[model samples]
Target: MAAASGDNPSKLFAMPAIVADRRDDGSILIRSTTPLKASARCVGDWLEHWARQAPDRIFLGERASIETPWSTVSYRDARGIVRRAASWILAKGLSTERPLVILSDNGIDHALLALAAQHVGVPSAAISPAYSLMSKDFDKLKSMIALLDPGAIYVASTKPFAAALAAIAPLHRATIVSGNPDDADALSFRTIAATPESSEVATAFAAVTPETIAKFLFTSGSTGTPKAVINTQLMLTSSQQAKAQTWTFLEQAGEELIILDWLPWSHTFGANHNFNLVLRNGGTLYVDGGKPAPGLFATSLANLRSVVPTVYFNVPRGFDMLIAALRTDDELRRKFFEGTKFAFYAGAALPQNLWDALEELSLQTVGRRLPMVSAWGSTETSPLATDCHFLAKRSGNIGVPIPGTELKLVPSGDKLEVRVRGPNVTPGYWKAPDLTAAAFDDEGFYKIGDAVTFADPDRPELGLFFDGRVAEDFKLNSGTWVSVGTLRVAGIAALAPLAQDIVITGHGRDEVRFLVFPNLAACRALAGLADNADAREAIGHAAVRSAIGQGLARLKAQGGHSSGHATRALLLAEPASVDGGEITDKGYINQRAVLTRRAAAVAVLEDDGASEPIGCAG
Candidate 1:
């Protein structure tokens, strides 16, 4: 039998057809015609080889224009372009080790150079160009820019970005592309690709092998400055290999597999999770030029409606918005999931209701619901660690360890911390050896930090569920420990209708309290308020929300934690902000940051007017 994730784990060893040569690391090297040497090659190396092998296949780029039947740059052409650009950069004495920085939004040229750079051993660092300028930390961004001292900077030929880069990278090695040219900088991204590098890029890509540093990506965590994560070509290659059994994604016959993605390029899910999958399997990706929650779904529905992607990946909010559109517009729903093979949701926990809605839509169109997978991983794990298959109900569990991975649950403070050891795991945070050492155990498995409860391991139905962050859970005054992850999931599920976001309170004292973010969408609908009518809608929304507020209060009253819990006070206004440190880029709340920022809310929960936080609850 094929190694679909639906197989029983106990029977896996007996099935020799699926299992391959066993490794010392408790992982089986499954059989594949994909070159064994190419197994761990960096992305650039992989692509360069593919370019030579299958030059005609589509490569890294958007389609010619809106009306073109074919979209994006094909692989063969992508190599040629990268080679030209690589020659331009290299001619300027660009070193392979000191990365080239991409300070722009997601686009075709952005992807091409990133992969191409990896082929030649020069790691590419793509930071959120938007996040760099005019923020609370200009130096913080400058420090990131300084991290690589980027020998060269590649800017999208577009406006604000082109204008922004001019201000951001003054006196730095700069080049411009005519494709999105807003400013007259040094060179064009596409025009430079037209520059000749026939011998240069081909020579570079062949040398970048398993150990070559593919990417030098950074992740901003709750604790400190954004630490860099070093990824090897092997890690990127293995990541692609691991997904072979989970998706028939690579099984498309001849037509290019199309993908329209709006997820941020910095995040693992947005970058490697979707992009790498499409790249490895020889698929075409359409960079959704719009942002999400609203901008993306409409474009995505339009793109997927006709093109029919081999796979689709969206966040929970994206799915929610799509459901709303689908419920009202059947044609959109039918077209949205039309030729879709499988779907994936990441970044946040998807409620059962949202998953149910997606399933209903899929079942209506295709007669059988397509599998919508949820993957779990950290930046340290090169992003995707575990992915659940869609054979059964959407359990929201992050499925089994992929082919080259080994998992363990180490009992830590008050919970068992999930750990994994695999090639996919980074070589540790860049320049943070001590931090990396502490991140793992004596056994060398990287400690995942979050607490997780072990589920079925053999048949492993819902592979494993994510508990809250190791730091989020706390105990009551009575000393009964409460898991923030569990409480949040339960609380959100209970208050799904009225919930947008909820911050559980009362850490040291009595029962747990919360600062909730209301479902403004639901509020708007219930209050009959239009989007732009903030003033007029607020008057009506206040009354409608107040009534719904009482319902939420009652809902929280019933859904207590461990015991009969009550939310001492919940003030609903203002969405959480990433810039303000209320949340991470991944949308995971910084509990400590929230606690410090909303000191008054916590104070109100403890002792209302007389406490240190008199004006806390807003």
Candidate 2:
């Protein structure tokens, strides 16, 4: 078995004893022996507690541009604004039936309004801006608005969401609130926040219970329409409590927790996990306006240069982009590694090459390498079911079940399907009775549709590695199962700096093949082309194709079976479509949706006579 990282003594993570029980029916139940620490009943309690404890500490910050300084709000100021806005929300009669819906990116105003709604027992829902701004049809936004039947809708600016507003105007009767004062048809966010706090605000806050819904976080809708997963007060608080216990350094480190994040608030990883972690620990969150995309990453790099976070959080794609920047920019590498505790990654499995690159950079900049860790969960579990408290032997180890959570690993075909039951788990989907009924097992554990395997079969405490999604895995013509998650990560590593992401084909065919989305920038560099070269020209360059062929040849040499290596690959010029449900807001590719949407591309690989594909033997 591989050993854990050597930096265990430096970081004070909770070392809990893990208990696993093997059932008679070929299932395993795992839980931590440690009990969950007492957590706040509602998220509002954290805001109130911090206001009393350290009122002047900075809680949130944002910048309009790289040249401008961050506009910050302290804990005391946030509470005051939240209470006043809570009074306005109470006057508007928002409740479980009529919630507040926000359609904007991450900003200071967005965070304040969300806190205000939650302060007085009104649930808030932050919808992804892509559904409104990126999609041509606005079909997903309309469906979500109809399902919510919101009491009020909010936007940071009316100009960007004009088309979406016009599209959803016929769907609901919700009041409109705009952060921009120039919007004539909407109420001003500044005016609503200036409402005088009254006795009604305190009464509503006091009435809040653990069962009260705090937010409605939507799933990625990989298979179908996005389901509004009900996030209750218990789910939010308990997840943070377990996080605090697992990562004991949050309290023991003595330095205030700081994070510069770009993950969308519409998803659970950002809203429930990262955002709430800062709130619960009296930490400060700098709202990062940049993402991992091509044109937008410069903003993120600027933010990193400005603010050195105590704990940095990102998905694998973000890290991949960061690695490129860090390799070229010496100042960024130094600022990013200075005083950083550990790097956390989620939303997808990080390629092992990226992991090693980060470690190498950290060691080169600082004397020691930063511990890269991960966790596992979904939108339904308030996003954290398992915590990697210890540095695992390598990447993809999502540690043992957290406190107040249980992982039931039931035998499913050749894989173990992991089901979760915990206080952090959501009660059910919002207003979807049939979907809710089908989501849980007879034992009440939420079936997450993912599979796992023990890192070490004899020692349960070693943690669990994420097997591929049960729905995404498929069998070949010879009846051999193909693990898409594991193989995809390996393929990306094998085709490093060439393949951005890959979709495994040959579900029922004779051999596995790959539909690769080439990294255009990397291809351009490899081809020695100018920066303005067309994407198709870059991808079709002979040098780019030769590099892919060489990478495939390397992968073939280390293969275990036909299912393990792709014999041929077709590089796709077009990117994954957001409207087609091919990619999530967090950048996770839906394997089934990609395959379904690009059936013709898959066909090209299957056809032996196709000349577009590059063979592994080349």
Candidate 3:
């Protein structure tokens, strides 16, 4: 590994001694030898600690628009506001049975309302805004509302959610609360924030325990309807505690941590991992209103120019977008690397090309490459099962199990299926007793359904790499297995700048194939088309098809087997649909959903006579 210029290696990472225990049955258990320290009782404890320790420090910052200045709230002020809001929530009869549900993006108001609800033992469910705003039918939102049976529903504005609210109006009698004071049909957020702090607020807060449900975060629903993953105070607090232990620099560095993040609070990566980490460490969180989409990424770049974060957190897609901006914009690159400890990615396995680009840019601008690291876990684990405390030699290393967690690697055919058990792990899915019971093994470990392998089999301390999902792997007619997650990442890297995301096909067929979602910008550039050229015109150009054919051929040359290399690929014009369960709000592609939804497209690839596919050369 190359040393980071002008950076002390000792201060940059915590090199914990990982211990792996090999079982006689070909299974393995791994964990960091470092013990987890005592954690806070609940999420409110962290807020209280920060409120007292850094009373005047800016806890949260956000903007109303691109042109507007940031509006910040101090820790002390946040506590006061939370207390008053908690009193109002308590008076509203919101409890475990009738939790608080939020239907808005990340903002100061949204944060305050969630904190208030959690502070008073009222679990808050932050549903993805896309479910309400993007979906025409609102079927997912209605189902979530029915499951939650919330006492109240909150939205930042009423206009965008008017249709969704009306869609679920017949399902529940929950009170509606809007951030916009002008919404006459709902109670105002501003009024609730200013509600008188009653004695009941303190009583309710004192009653909160470690096992108390802090929030309900829904899964991406890749296979079926999204399940409500119960996040307890213990799960949240212990996860952060394990993190602080792994990344000792957060406290050792003595600098106030600052982050500019756009990941939605609805997802565990953003909520329990990033958001809670900031609060636990008394850091300032700039709630970016941007996303990693086409028009929205420009806003993220704008925010990055203004705020040089101490640490940056994003998914592979977000980093991919940011890398493009950073390569050309010298000013943005310099600012982004300056005062930055490292860059973290999750949500999907990052393509090696993207990782190489980021390192190259960091070296060019900062004279040293920043540590690009990742962790592996799901919403049910409070999202922090493993931590890459040391710099990984490759792109996909998810490191070792964090201090309180135990990873049981049981052999499942060609892969090791990883199961997790710890205080950080969720008990089960909310309101579904069957799912709760079926989620665990006989020994009480949460069956995460993901597979992993040792980075260095002989040297257990080197950590592990994320293998594809167990359910995603399929057998060909020759009885060979194809790892979808591994192949997808490799394919994206091999196709570089052309394939944005690829879905593997041929579950029981003789060979693997790809349903690629082409990157329109790159295709247009390759085809020598105008920036505003029609999507079909650009993608169908001879030059674009030739380039794709060459990429596919190149991928085939780096041979493994028929299951490893995709024999043919078809470029998709229509993007993955959020309502169809083809994609998640965080930009992760659901392979099964995509294949099931686009059966005709799959049939096209399976047909030898289909001329649309770019065939791989022998």
Q: Where does candidate 3 clash, by residue pair?
A: none
lDDT of 1 by residue, 306-353 (tens): 455656777766676667777887776676666565677877667677
Where model 2 places Cα greater than 4 Å from the true spot, the runs are: 1-10, 252-255
lDDT of 3 by residue, 1-618 (tens): 447534565676678688889999998888778888999999999899989988998999999777889999999999999999999999989998899999999999999999999999999999999899999899899999999999999999899899999999998879999999999989999999999999998899999999999999999886668999999999999999999888887774322689899999999999999999899988999988888887788888888888889889998888888888887898888888876778899999989989899888888888889888899999999999998888887799998999989999999998999999999999899989999999999988999999998988888778899999999999999999898999899899888788889999999999899999988888998988987888888778998888777887777777568877888889998989988989888889999899999999999999999898888855
| C-alpha lDDT values of all predictions | 0.63, 0.90, 0.90
**Candidate 3: minimum summed lDDT over ten consecutive residues — where?**
1-10
Candidate 1 wrongly placed segments (more than 4 Å)? 1-40, 49-54, 60-71, 133-137, 157-159, 162-179, 248-256, 294-296, 390-392, 457-462, 535-572, 584-588, 604-618
lDDT of 2 at 353: 94
Q: Pick the candidate with the highest lDDT.
A: 2
Candidate no. 1 TM-score: 0.85
Clashes within 3 Å, all models in order:
20, 0, 0
* TM-score to true structure, per model: 0.85, 0.98, 0.98
Worst 10 residues of 2 by lDDT: 1-10
Writing each residue's lDDT as its tens digit, candidate 2 over 510-606 gives: 8999999888889999999987799989988999888888888888887769888889999998988888998877888889999999999988889
Clashing pairs in 2: none
Ranking by lDDT: 2, 3, 1
Model 3 ranges off by over 4 Å: 252-255
